[model samples]
Target: MRDTQRTILVFGATGQQGGAVARALLRAQWAVRALVRDPAAPKSIALREAGVELVRGSFADIDVLRAAMKDAYGVFSVVPSSPSGAVTDEEEVRFGTAIADLASESGIAHLVYSSGASVGEKPTGVARFDTKARIEAHIRELPVTATIVRPVIFMEMLVRPGFGLDKGRFTFFLRPNQSMQLIAVDDIGKFVTAIFADKMRFSGETLKIASDTVTGRELETILTEAAGRPIAYARFPDEVLAANPYLRQLAASLDEGPLADHVDLNVMRELNPEILSFRSWLAGSGRKALDEALGTTGLGL
Candidate 1:
């Protein structure tokens, strides 16, 4: 059983990763407190309704962050990166390091930082991922009990509209025979919940998590079975890669190995037995997204 008296300070509670973690912590019976820019926003209100204590503020507000961390047993840190153009790489490093420094200074018991799979000892040269690497490095040096989780590509991204699901085809970075790992967003919560549950085993560890590993051909089979129609799977053509520098760089990363197969599924399953594979995700929480991508349903989840 969890200690209901112990609270967790979760950052980015209204966003995808933070929202998932906050909900999972609540489900596990841990008291959750979140800092949000607008407490009246629909997502923020929903979080409050679900029992998360809301603190009105942004990442730039140091006093608010310090106040929220007060008396919290643990902190879950995730910051926005340059990909969204919301914050620059420098700002991301600052926010991440600031959270760690504050958590350490506040005497928080444990700190869990969510990073990208591509981030590692050496820089990947991708500013977004390298930025996470910098943050991870900074956290390791802090006087804090920190655990870093590097999640692979999200299964949800595969079903998004531009991926060609609407045209009865799937276009991604993997070649037909090449394989990559993927994790459902919900499963991220499950893993983090387990981490928070067993700090002794997970603390000071950097875990790479994924629910399943599949090749392009396997994806086609799974999508075809789920959609009840043939969904051709193909890698982004050279012409498309040439036209988009960002896509080209991502594809190069996949081919060169940072974004390729690396997770140990057996270990991940041991941490969270309910982890969802691509097929299982499509049949459950991922269904509506897939339907919308396939043009079988209207927008707005």
Candidate 2:
């Protein structure tokens, strides 16, 4: 189908993944439609300025979803999980499966669902990670042509205000030499745009995507170089992990291998050569955030 005749409906447009997808889709000359909770919000307004049509509604509204899906060639689905506390795990599953069902019923040619990389051949029993696994199973059972993109831990999350950056140190999931895969958020858009542009090749496939991998020691070196200051690196203290169930689960997952990323860098480069490494990201789009993070000290990861 011609780009002019095609529209891709995107959820979470006001947030990271959806925003990236919308921006990339527009740059590629495809009509982009976003389902938003507030059309008057700054992000939504920016989307409008950039030529995205906005449909104001929530996932709970069936009529809103139907209207947004009308005449849309593809649907890029990424829903908020337990982190937002905007919904429970059951609610997350309900919304996710519902979107797939809606897309199928709407006759969408392609449906691309973004899920977490931690999901594996079996459920990890982590609420956040397992939630996507459930969603993936539901999408697979649907009659619609679908693609599942499992993204690793976001590179952006590494440089957030907390996590000891202000104290001239960094604490994360991996040991000093244990590598973890990470992806730049914008690259997610690049990948999805390619998938939408070539539906036949991507449909029915589940892809694990990561731009780069780095160990904790590597993160220390990279951050120090980027910040032009000394920044030590260490794994989360056992005491801290033991106290926080969430952090403890994540740390355990890393140790056990389920949370560890196994994406092939060479193949991902072929798919998206513009993908940024951790240092390149800190040098580029991440510069401002890193600068801000280094200037403040917040608690927790």
Candidate 3:
């Protein structure tokens, strides 16, 4: 007995996590409204065609956010961070906190903030990771029912170009024997939709989410099987880590365990029965991305 009239204001709807959330919410018969910078964009049009209401604005505009939040039952918030160089860490914190503040003021019943898995009780010394910690703290202080979802590294990221996919070899943050958790972007939507569906259960909860875990060696086997061609896998070389401060910090964080995902796969399976494993993703949603990655000459270490 869900209310079909209830609407969820979704940020980043044109992007991965938001798009998945929008689609999932729509499938569950919830009205979805998205804040987009351009209503004319093809993705925005697609969202509109998919029955999402598009509100044109940026996160910097509080008025736009307030307008979008008006009468909305819930909000799905996911803001992009650095390396995209779209916003500084400070700006990210500001935007995230502002969304929570406005949602609280607008009397929205639930606000789900999507954060990174590496974020925990303390700062990871990485700007992006620390930035989310600040926002999470601020959300807790607000007078709102908020659920924080810290999703692990995306399975989609692995198949993206520049991961050595084009060369039939893959280099990533994990060592051969070490394991890391990964989740499909689509499942992030599933998890969020479930959270919205059961506000009482997830309210005030911080859930670290991931569907599957794999080691570097396991990745090789999976990718080889998926590609029907041998695909090798290796950790990023020491020199590459030494030369790139960002990559080095990420690797160091993983080595120290904060960046390594510690998700309860069993609980996740219960919450999202349609959760995808690495092998299933490679065979399904990730197939096109993998094909494109393999065909591109990417800058890999």
Candidate 4:
């Protein structure tokens, strides 16, 4: 059981990953405090209603961050990255490192930093990933008990507009038989909650988390079954790859094995018994998003 008196300062609580962690922590009976840029935002208000203490501030608000950490038992740190144009890669490194530094200084018992699965000891030449690598390095050097969670690509990303779900076709970085690991966003919270529950076990550990691995063909079959219609799946055409350097680079990384076959599903299931598979997610929390992506009200799958 968690200590009821213990509070966790959660960054990015209004965002996807942070919101998942915050909700899971609260459900586990851990007091959660969130830092939000706008306390009046609907998400923030919802979080407050859910019993999370809200601290109004951005990542740049050091004074606010410090105040939020005071007397907190743990910290769950995640930051916006350059790809979203929310912050530059340099700013990402600074915010991540600053949070680690503050957690250490505040004598916070545990810190969990969310990073990308693509980030590793050597830079991947990807700004977003390399920025996290720098932060992980900084956290390791700090006098703090910290866990680094590198989550693979989120299942949510596959449903985004450009993925062609609406067109009854899907294009991605993988070939038909090639596989990539994916995690439901909610599973990230489950894993984090488990980690926090056993700080001694996870301390100083870098865990790569993913709920399921599927081939591109598997994605087509799943979507077809869910949508009640065929959805073709294919890798981005060579011409498309040639035109999009970013997409091409991501594909190259996958081929190089950095983003595939790294996670241990058995271990993930051990840590989070209820961890969601792609099919399970599509049937539950991901159902609505899938419907929206398909531009349908419901397929009744």
Candidate 5:
């Protein structure tokens, strides 16, 4: 938690979680060392311009990871989850465990891992995100002072095509009367910064991080207000889930429990002042994506 230490080595600096961590650390006046696959990439270049020591690296290469983390104060860890098809469940566990091992061996001070909301101390049946569960377990078994943050579904994902946003409707994992947790990605960084600043309280703690809960009915009202048009909300059709086994299983998991009405949003905004509700984010940071999702016609949600 000491800000005067070497630096915070951030993996996936080009992606959402790591980018948030890097920016927050910089604002806290901590030295930032970011690992990226291509430091020359525009985003990586931008990080460099912002005073981060961008190290060209990939998660698969341990030497690069080691080189980046050498003598660092802490490490912000997040795996590229498999929902995108770029990684398998097995690959995600491998990267997560490997990083924890490396962090332990290198004497990294504090390790904050970005895990998924669906993951808990006990196992859920979903393979797509349960990988985070496995990794969280692995981290706890290690000797490092680590904090695990399990984030709920992103509010930004609401507008994806598969959600039925393109058809003046919204279809999602939640039922019509159910409430589900959601968070803005920008809030992830601020929450993490606060965690890093007070390691004594947060160290070795597992957190289920979310900002708000919305029922399908509430989502309909909010989206309609934002778009200045009617946007009806409905649960995913049985046939649609039947056609897509992964989504069907995912929906079934939510129907079962844990996915809906799981976190306390009132306590969240108290912990972190930047927790933005869906309505506020739409009028603010989410405006561009809201516009695009409103106009989008096809592809995955």
Candidate 6:
């Protein structure tokens, strides 16, 4: 945690969660060594400017990971799931496990893994979420002190095109009365930094992280109030779910209760007091994007 000292090798440094973690670690004065595939990427350049050491590497390369971890205090690892279709579930587990194994074998002090919120004591039978389940189990057997963080659904996704930020209406996986928790991408770093700073409290533990919980109706009210328009929110229609198997399975997971009912929001807030509720996030980091998406080139339904 000291400046000009041990380094923390961060994977996915160019992406949202990784970017947040890298920035937070840099701010805390930790020497960050980012294992980026392309060190010349725009975000990678910005990271270099901020004092993060960029080491060109990919998850699939053992030598690359070894070089990155050669003299690191800890490693922040997160594999990209199916969001971009870059890797399948099997590939995700492979990369995640390989990273942990190499980090431990290299004598890294700590390994902080970022997993999805939906992963729990029991699998939800979804390959995407279950992939983390397998990786988490494997990390437990490693010889490194590790902290596993399970983050809730990202709030940024709600503001994207298909979510109705521009049309004054939105579709999501929530019944009018069912509650769901969400986390801001920025806060993920804050919590993670705090975790890295205090190893004794976080080590040997798996913590669930979330900022706010909302019912579908409550989300509608907040979005409406924030946009100064009547933004209605409702669950995706049955017909719509039937049209997309992925959407249908996701909706079913929530309805079955494990996805929504397992988290303790109060504990998360206690751990990271700076956690921003969904509404607060909307009015802050999301404001400019919302303005562009809704005010200028509106998102067409």
Scored by TM-score, the top model is 4
Candidate 2 residue-wise lDDT, 1-301, digit = tens: 3365699999999999999999889988999999989989899899999999999999999888998899999999999997898989988999999999999999999999999877888867678888999999999999999999998889999988788888899988678988888999999999999999899999899998888988889999999998778999998889988887777777776777566647789999887879999999988998878887888324222
List candidate 4 segments past 4 Å from native: 1-4, 298-301
lDDT of 5 by residue, 160-276 (tens): 655666568877767788777788888888788888778889989988888778888999999989877799988877888888866776676577645653777777877787788
lDDT of 4 by residue, 107-153 (tens): 99999999988886677776887899999999999999999999998
In candidate 5, position 170 carries an lDDT of: 79
Candidate 2 versus the native: TM-score?
0.95
Q: Which scores better on TM-score, 2 or 4?
A: 4
lDDT of 1: 0.89
CA lDDT of 294 in candidate 2?
89
Q: Which runs of model 1 end up more than 4 angstroms from their true locations?
A: 1-4, 242-245, 298-301
RMSD of candidate 3 to true structure, Å: 3.0
Compared with the true structure, model 6 gives a TM-score of: 0.92
Give RMSD to native, each candidate.
2.1, 3.1, 3.0, 1.7, 3.3, 2.5
Mind giving the per-residue lDDT tens digits that candidate 3 earns over 1-301? 4464599999999999999999999999999999999999999999999999999999999999999999899999999897678998888989999999999999999999999887878766778888989999999999999999999889988887788877889888789998888999999999999999999999999999999988889999999888767899888889999887767876776787566646779999999999899999988988888888888325231
Deviation in Å, model 5, residue 96 alpha carbon: 0.7
In model 3, residue pairs whose N, Cα or C atoms come closer than 3 Å (at least 3 residues apart or on different chains), thus clashing, are none
Candidate 1 lDDT, 1-301, residue by residue in tens: 5565699999988988999999999999999999999999999999999999999998899998999999999999999998888899999999999999999999999999999887756766668888899999999999899999999889988888899888989998788998888999889888998999999998899998899999999999999999988999999889999887667766776787577647788888899988888999999999998999999885432
TM-scores for candidates 1 onward, in order: 0.95, 0.95, 0.94, 0.96, 0.92, 0.92
lDDT of candidates 1 onward, in order: 0.89, 0.89, 0.90, 0.91, 0.82, 0.84
